[model samples]
Target: MDEVQVGAGGATDFARWTGEFEAKVVARAAAGDPDWARGARLDPAVARSVQRFQVGESGDGANLIGKADRAGDPVYSAAVRLFIAEERNHARLLGLLLRAGGQPTLSGHWTDAVFVRLRRALGLRVELMVLMLAEVVALRYYRALRDGTTDALTTQVAGLILADEQRHVPFHCQRLRVAFAASSRPARLFAVAVWWVLMVGVTAVVAVDHGPALRQFGVRRADFGRGVFGLFAVIVPSAIPLRDPVRIA
Candidate 1:
């Protein structure tokens, strides 16, 4: 794999991200998982919905790691590994939450399968772009889970994953800003346009697929889609600048 070049003086420092992820590792080790003995009471609709998200979060991330390593930024590669670990932890937490509620974790889901295929079909930049759609969607979905649910254990678990995801959007943006720093304006615009299209399509699928659970959470399907696009509106400019980014850090 060839290195994705960023113009000199424009490379975003990823050491900050590495340090943040490391600090999180320490903090998580200290704080530990939410008490599962308390158990959870999930609506059948919500449980089915969470089962699909758990599958989305579960992956080896070898392809992403390999691409990061070949991108020639050890600090960024290290940060990406930490990022993947946190995602896996989300899957674990969700699985545990489901078990505590007497629901079984799913082996797979068609939606997750489609996302994995789409992400794997591209290079590092494109993969991250595809991934950002999921991240943005998760930001909303988890927030709804955290705030809209009456289940204490579910709220706690969603809060934890939501916090990590809040950081994840900007972390990916920092790298993406650098990735696009050398591209032409028209190219960046084209990429952003495509990203928006993908976001709309994916959000629509999720909104329909999870509408029942979202209703249980008191969020309408239209509102869920709106919230996802709202988050994405903020992310696109951060990741893809129409004018050259002044600084990515």
Candidate 2:
């Protein structure tokens, strides 16, 4: 199947995952545990960051799937759909943490709005590359949180989520490699520019928001850089070979 078809199928899968995720969030919300609520309130910065995280997942995932659907590619669509599913699970995990601490979970609308505007301005491939970079960064953050926290539940949830994020790096890089390979010289150049911009932008955001949370959690901010490098080392090298023409499945 073509990239467009794959994207469309991924969008449909995203929609399905969104519904399932919503159900889980609602159930967790109703549970109303004080420790969960306290944890939710433990770090305002972290809460805001998680809210932004959800927004990116919902808005960006929807946009990617929508574009891929228009273009018609089942493989691309399926990969993105899997992305949406994983993101939804991340949101649900955050929601569960919020509920356990006894705080209200914020909606993902803010991040979604930011993503929508960015997508219109940047185009799909650039947007996706940036999103992937952010995901890779997030995977590192979560992994650190998992390792640092002694709370059994927090550790377990973060560990599971981190494992899923490990899968995301390759999937995202695969799609990006395929897209870049299929493009002309000019398109590739444009993609490179966008990749740098995204890398810088996400790095700035992480520095401001996620950085402090790590400190509060008793982890050093420098660890984030190391983690990002680790993720890049794994993903970028694997993607290099496919820069010319690659089958993404």
Candidate 3:
């Protein structure tokens, strides 16, 4: 990945994002990976949960890249490629974590299948909206996995993925801010409403699906849902300004 720095006001600076991602790639290479040889001890439920998330992260991202190319922003397109690479790296990390725990990665998961279908069913803006949902949900999940687990290797892997996911959210948000910049107030408000509904639905599904694992980490299902909502509260305003925003020239 490259090194990227969001400029003042978090402007749409894809070049910075590209550099950041590249820098991350360099840093990751230099740091190397966690010692998988130590092995991990994962609860059965947690292993199952991680398997599903691994499936979610394991995608070619061809559709997203195609959409980005069609968007006609070459810099953004390049940055998106690095973003996808990082996501695939997340899958790799999770798979290795499972292996360390003597578990196999799932061949597929219904939740991931549905999510991929939903994201690919629309244009880049819509795709990004759907992707943002995953990114935000992952924020809470990886945090719990990192902080709640006793296994040092599992914690390390989760922490790494969490770091990338934190970057991913605002990166997508910056693009989406531009995407909605030309919309009317009424339109923006409507988008905010719709986004809220979708977020609630998705969070509920995830909480229900990962309930056992979340409980293992001492996170109540309701608490998980609330946490996701809390995160999205910030995102909705950032991504879709309901008030008339000064156009970014």
> What TM-score, computed on C-alpha atoms, does each candidate reach?
0.94, 0.69, 0.95
Compared with the true structure, what per-residue lDDT tens digits does model 1 show for residues 151-189?
999999999999898889888887888899878898999
Model 2 lDDT, residue 63, Cα: 66
Score each candidate by Cα lDDT.
Answer: 0.89, 0.58, 0.89
Q: After superposition, how far is residue 26 of candidate 2 from its true place, in Å?
A: 21
- Candidate 3 residue lDDT tens string, 118-141: 988999999999998899899999
Residue 225 error for model 3, in Å? 0.9
Across 19-57, the per-residue lDDT of candidate 2 in tens digits comes to 544554476469533244334334665555555654455
Task: State residue 221's C-alpha deviation in candidate 3, in Å.
Answer: 0.6
Give candidates' CA RMSD values in order. 5.0, 7.4, 3.0
On lDDT, the stronger of 2 and 3 is 3
**Model 3 clashing-pair count:** 14
